[model samples]
Each structure stands twice: as C-alpha cells, then as structure tokens.
Target: MITQNSINQLTYEIIGAAIEVHKILGKGLLESVYHKCMIEELKIRKINFKSEFKVPINYKGVDLDFDFKCDLFIEDLVIVELKAVNEILPIHDAQLLTYMKLLSVPKGLILNFHSNNIFREGQKTLVNEHFKNIPK
Candidate 1:
C-alpha cells in the first residue's frame, strides 16, 4: 500500500525539479516549454511518471467519449498539473481536484511556471479523502 509519507517524498522531489527548471529558465515561458523541461528533469531524477496520461470519464456505469488528460501522473499516486498562467487561479485548483476525484488519486500538485519565485508562490498542493486515509 502507498503511504502518505512516500507520496510526500515523491512530491518533494518533483517540487525540487520544478524549482531547478524555474531557476534555469526563469519565468514567462509557454506552458508546454515548462512541461517539456519538467519531463527532462524528472527523467534525470529517475522519477517514474506518465506524461499526458489519459483518464476516461464514466457516468452512471456508462463510459463517456470525453477523457481528461492529466499533465503528469507520478508513481500512479499523485497528479502533477503544469501551467504557465500569470497567477494560480481557483479554476486551476478546481480542475486538479476534479482530476483527483476522477482518478481516485490521493494528492496533486499544480505548478505554475510563470511566477518570479516558483517555490515560494508558483505551486499549490491539493489533497482529498484518499489522502486523508493514507498512513503517515
């Protein structure tokens, strides 16, 4: 079983990679640019992740044609959503939360790469009931 501590460790490493990308690239790049750079960083760090992983939508025992593509799914435990917005928005958080609910993930990180300080102000980590039940 996955533990909260383990997921926290993985997220910590992910944040470090994002910080490194931010330090080297600085702000104001496109979201796709950050996404690609983060992919490389995660690779160098040997983090197991799936990029643009698809999540199928099912409603009332019916599978929908629409699906949600999460930016990154790390260790199949956490979702990493990349953005390059001017600021983190409520909609972004809501989107991540929705993804977590659909994917049944414990936690998620929304990393916006357009901030001057990525670590201090560009990241937000959200959790759900799955997270609450995880062992510390």
Candidate 2:
C-alpha cells in the first residue's frame, strides 16, 4: 500500500542517490552516464530499481509492441526519468506525467544530472490522482 509519506520518503532517497551520482561524476556528461551512475549509487544504497522497463500500450484493447520504455522503474513504485540537460522544462514534466497516466502509477520523478547543485535544481516530483475525473 503506497502512501504519500512513503512516496515522500522514497523521493528523498532517490534524490540522495542522484546527488551521490552527481558528486561522483560531476556535470557535463551524457544522460546515460548519469543513469548508470545513479544505478550504481542505488545499488550501493540497497535501493531496488529497474532500468528501461517496458510500458505496454493498449490500443482499443490490443496491446502494442514495446509502446513506451521508462528510464527507471523503482520497485514498481515510481517512474524515474533521468535527464542530462541544463534545466528540466515543462515538457519533461509532461512526459513524466504521461508515463504516470499510461502506467496507472501514482507518482513519478524527473531528475536532471547536468546541474551544479543536483538537489536544488535537478529534482522534480509529481503525483497523479487515482480518479482523475473529479470536478475541481
């Protein structure tokens, strides 16, 4: 049973992992480099995660072939998108939101690795409503 508190704790852990990765690798590297370093850090921290996991697509009840691939699926809990860019833009957040919707996930994270301060400028977390059709 995933809760907001659990999600928040996990988010902190993930951010810590990202900071460790940035500390080791510094900036100006490829996204893959950060991805790999983060994975290593997660391993050292005993965090369970999957990389490049398949996100199936159902089209009118038909499953599509390899529809979407998530960067990191952590404990089947959250989607982690690794970015090696100057800043994380709205499009990046939108992309993660789309992944959360399609995967029927409750939460996601967007982590950028090309920043001087990874914690301050690199992490963005999001959550989606379980029932998204409510009137606001």
Candidate 3:
C-alpha cells in the first residue's frame, strides 16, 4: 500500500532526477527536451512512470470524450508537470492542481527547466486531501 512516507520519498527521488537532468542539460531547452531527459533520468533511477498519461474529464456525471494529458505519471500516485518557461506562474500551479483532481491523484510536482538553480527556484510540490489521508 502507498503511504505518506513512501510518497515523500518518491518525490525526493523525482526531484533528484530532475536536478540531475538540469545539471547535465543546463537550461534554455524546450519542455519536451527536458521531458525526455527527465524520462531518461527516471529510468536510470529505476522509477516507474507513464509518459503523457491521459486523464478523462467528467461533468455532470457524464464522461467527456476528450481527456487531459499529464507530462509524467509516477507510480500511478504522483503527477509530474514539465515546463521550460522563464518562471512558474499561477496558471501552471492551477493546471497541475486541476490534473491532480481529474486524475484523482494525491500529489504532483511542477518542475521548470529554465533556472540555474532548479531545486531552489524551479520545483514545486503540491498535495491534496488524498495525500492527507495516506498513512504515515
């Protein structure tokens, strides 16, 4: 079973992978570039994930034919959003949050690959009530 501690540890690993990718690739690449590098890093780290995972949208008890795609779905528990923008805006956070809700996921990370210091200035982790309910 998934636990809070496990999720935290996985997030740490995810951030470490992102940091390694940034260290090698530096900045100014496209989001897709960083995404491919991240996937490589995650594979090197032996982390299970799905690329471009799709989440269906439902409204008024009806499922929509179209779906939203997330950058990375980690262990079926966390969502990773990749960005190559100058900075992470509120809309980015909103987008991740919306994906989390639609996917019924507990946690997510927004990793922007456009900063010299990716850890300090380029990463953000968000959790929802599903995370709160996880056992410690």
* Top of the candidates by TM-score: 1
Query: What's the true lDDT of residue 94 in model 2?
Result: 87
Candidate 2, residue 36: CA error in Å? 0.9
Per-candidate TM-scores read: 0.96, 0.89, 0.95
Location of the lowest summed lDDT over 10 successive residues in candidate 2:
127-136
Q: Of models 1 and 2, which has the larger lDDT?
A: 1
10 residues in a row with least lDDT, candidate 3? 62-71
Would you give me the overall lDDT of model 3?
A: 0.93
**In candidate 1, what are the lDDT values of residues 61-122, reduced to their tens digit?**
99987667999999889899999998888999998998899999999999999988878999
Candidate 3 TM-score versus the reference: 0.95
Give every collision pair in model 1. none
Ranking by TM-score: 1, 3, 2
Clash count, one per candidate: 0, 0, 0
Off by over 4 Å in 1: none
Candidate 3 residue lDDT tens string, 76-99: 999999999988999999999999
The alpha-carbon deviation from the true structure for residue 14 of candidate 3, after best TM-score superposition, in angstroms, is: 0.4
